[model samples]
Target: MALRVTFVLPVFPRAPVGGFRVVYEHANRLTALGCQVTVVHERWREGWSRPLRHLREAARDHRHRRAPHRAIDWLPVDPRVRLLIVPALTPAHLPSGDVVVATHWKTATLLPYLTPAHGSPVHLVQGYETWNVPDPAPVHQALRLPFPKITVSTHLTRVLSDLGVHSGQITTVPNGLDRTTYRPPPTGAPRAGVAFLLSDSAAKDSRTALAALHQVRAHHPALLARAFGVAPRPRDLPPWIHYAQGLTGEDLAAQVYRPSAVFLCSSTTEGWGFPAAEAMACGTAVVSTRNGGVEDFCHHNQNALLVEVGNPTAMANAIRRLLDDEPLRTRLSTAGLATTATMDWQQSTAALLTALKAIS
Candidate 1:
């Protein structure tokens, strides 16, 4: 019998995000493997307590449910995979399946309420998730649930252990690189510019990235920098740093990843660093903070330069070093490419299936 897997997301993403992208990738691959896959987007959660805000969001979700295809036009989802936008995470809105997976801490809280018909419940821990909520007590509580946990990094496994999840109950399934979309160009060109992802989230630490760029610009006055994200460019952003909003797939590779000399990651934390891996796959050297997300594939002065998180001066120094030494940059880029080449969606998805089977 084919496995029936259903994923519950906290909400439909209004824009492209790493967490959502990972789910979509797994859904596509699993469908190819003959698994029955369905992704449920909880339109209205308890977090939006205000009546006006709740009504507004519910109305938007109704529009998406009416035309589900347009809701995720930004992502490449398999048409065979079912997409559902529900009013809430109630059992009444969910379909029974072989196994139901929770993609967020909030979604995990609802798993216990689901009957056996909803299938075995499992929590997919992409990050520590303490940063996502104002009060982390609930996040910790969610981690402590008896449900089996699937995490993306060693750091996250350790975190779950601290929260009292048994080591045997936790599985690590790292995110994979899409080689077809992110790879080196036919020929290398002069790529003097630096690139990084921009986000409104404070945890992404875009301020630290900007500060590091400022320090680099002090030495190389005409240094070129590019940042891309779903958010519009902030008004205070310096004109020298070009911002490209919502670039993905081939366009992202051609515009931001391929032409960059170095990719910068200033995030304080992550379950997995998707952008860094994609950039490395494109043969661009990387200078990133010691964020847990990148530790899986990045090495200090090997595949990429790793610095302490939240330090603009140290990140700036590493970026400067990569900029000054062409040979070292090429060496790191070559090594980075080799490192990411082994991380493929096929391997990660197989691991995920194994984890789900164990819980099921």
Candidate 2:
């Protein structure tokens, strides 16, 4: 018999952000594997005026069609995967299943109130999300809960262990890349330039990336700079920097990673830095700070160059070294390709299923 798996999500299904993408991929792949999967999402927020909210949702849907980055475009269509939209996440509103997953801290806190009739609760710890919220104590307490845990990286595994979770209670499943979509371009060498992600989040630290690029430009006056993100292009970005907003997965591979010589990441933290791995898979060398979770694959002076976070000068120096030394760049690029080759999504998904089966 197939296991009935349900994921309790805090937000309405939308564009695949780093965290949400993982949830979407798991739900989609599990359905393909013949599991009966259900994704439960909130349909409306409490205290919102229904008429006004409807109008706003209509406008947002129109905008999403024009630029999908504004919202989610890829949702599972398999008949085995069902979407249940409810008013809220109270115990009465959740559905019963063979296995139920709490995808975020808020949901994890509710697990104790639920019984096995709601299925066994599994905490999918994507990251140390307390950093983004105003009150972290609740999230911290949730970490110590007795639920079985699955972390996306070793950094998170360590974080949970530090929180006093027993090693036997947690499993680490690293993220994977779609090699067919991210492979190196078929032709000439990558163009001389640097590519990075742009975002408004404080943790992303896009300003530091800009500062680093500015420092590099002082030496290589004509060095190319490119950036892409889900958000619309910012007004303050330098005019010479090529910026593309709302690029799809295929567009990101073709327009940004495939042609860039180096991928620069300056994030203060990450569950798993997907862009860095994707760029590396496309044969672009990576220069990044010691962002958490990226440590899973980024080996300094091996597959990529690492620097201290929040230091523009160090980031600039690393970018320049890569630009000046063709041999070093080539070595890192080759090693990065090899690293990604081993990280197949099929393998990663199989590991996740194995864990879920044990729970069932």
Candidate 3:
């Protein structure tokens, strides 16, 4: 019989963000293997009066797709694959399946309280969403008991270990890139000097980067700054910064690193520093704060220039270094490309499949 799996993510089918993309890729890959997946996630609620045209555009492409008659957008899910709409705040019940993976802390707790209980529940930890939840003790205790942990970074692996999870019980699953899409554009336009890793999130620290860039632009008059995946309304942003929201696949890969001389990520933490790796692959030097697992992939003053987190002066200085020094930028960029070779989604899926098989 085909393997049956259920993924409990807080939001699915609605949000078109990086996390959603990761989940989708893994789901599609697994489905190709005669496995079935049920995704339990939150519905998207659009507050603005944007284009229903785009919603219709998306729905037309997918057969099981449902467009919001009121204010929701649902994916055209496969019959074999199920999409369960669950409340954002409530804990979910794990349906019987060969595997049940709860993506965040809220859903992770559900595994411990299963109707008949479960085998080892797969808990995928990205960042401190585990730490930020109401009370982590239940999840922590479960991790020590029946939960086999799957993390995306050495940093997260270490953090979970600190929380009493056995090192052996946990395996590191790094993120990957689609090289064909994100590779450098053939025209090779003059590098877009100003770039951001993402500033809006708690880790990204948008205010600090914005203030520092305001200072940097005065010196480099022609400098143009672009925020990736931060501001939804691109036009509403201050005229100084350029806005490119929701660019993924090959286009996101190409624009973020390929032509940009320097890519910036101000986040003090990450499960894996995906933007840094992607940028490096595109031959773009990275200027990131000394936060999270960036060091795992980046060497300061070597392949990537690392600044102290929240230090606008240091961030501006690092960007200046890349700006004035082309050889250093080339060196970092080339090194970044070399780093991307080792990490691929195949590694993550293989490990995940192993864990899923064990669950049954």
Candidate 4:
């Protein structure tokens, strides 16, 4: 019999999100491999305990459940993949399968309540996602749940182990790059801009990256700085910084990553640093902070330059070095492309499947 797999997500995203993207990737691939795969989205998960918010969300969830197609139009989900939108993640809302995977700490809370027919429960730890809650203790406690855990990086594996999740229970399956869409621009294409992602989240440290760009501008007044995000361009961003709002897939590759000579990853922390990996796959040199997410694929001075977290001056200098030294930039870009080439989706999905099957 084909393995039956079910993935429970916190909510359906209206915009692009890295953690959610990973889950979709696996869902599509697992379905292709002949598994009976179903992805469940809770239409009414408020993630907190406010009565007013609950009432507001309850109304919004009703609207979403009726028009879920509008929310997922931006993503390219495989036709064979089964999508289920439920009011909540309780066992009563879930379908029985050989394995049920929790894609977030909040969703993991449902695993303990599920019976065997819902499949052996598994947790997919994409990040140390403590920022969402006021108390990180619950997040840590979820890691200790007696279920197999799949983490995106070795750093996350160590995090789980430190929290008493046995080493034997954690599997490290790095996120993969789709080379067909995220490859180097056609030979002789313009690779002359520096790029970074804009975000409202403090952990992403967009202020540090923006400050570094300003410093780089002091030396190279005509430097082209490009930024993109799902959110509208901030009014305060300098008029010179070209912002592309909400670009994805081929358009994101052709317009943002391919034109850039360098990509900046200034996040203080990440589970897998998706944009940096995508930029590298586009053969763009990278100057990143020592964010744990990039550690699995980035090597300082080998594939990319790494600096400390929250230091604008150091980030500025590193960007200057790449802009001034053409050969060094070329070397790093070449190396980055080579490094990211190994992160194949087939391999990552296979590893995830193996872990799920073992637990099942």
Best by TM-score: 1
lDDT of 2 at 165: 96
TM-score of each: 0.96, 0.92, 0.82, 0.95
Output the better candidate (2/3) by lDDT. Answer: 2
RMSD of each: 1.7, 3.2, 5.3, 2.1
TM-score of 2: 0.92
Candidate 2 lDDT for residue 128: 85
Write one digit per residue (lDDT tens) for candidate 3, span 224-270. Answer: 87667735754556776766676655666665566678888887676
Task: Pick out the ten consecutive residues of candidate 3 with the lowest summed lDDT.
Answer: 67-76
List model 1 lDDT by residue over 155-244, tens digit each.
899889987889999899998888999999877576877999988787799899999999999998999999999888889889999989
Quick one: best lDDT, which candidate? 1
Which window of ten consecutive residues has the lowest lDDT sum in model 4? Answer: 65-74
Kindly list the per-residue Cα lDDT of model 2 for residues 151-211, writing each as its tens digit.
9999999989988999999999887678888889876754679999998888889999999
Question: Compared with the true structure, what per-residue lDDT tens digits does model 4 show for residues 175-242?
Answer: 88798888998778767869999999988999999999999999999999899998998999998899
Of candidate 1, the 10-residue stretch with the lowest lDDT total is: 42-51
Candidates sorted by lDDT, best first: 1, 4, 2, 3
Backbone Cα, N, C clashes tallied per candidate: 0, 2, 4, 0
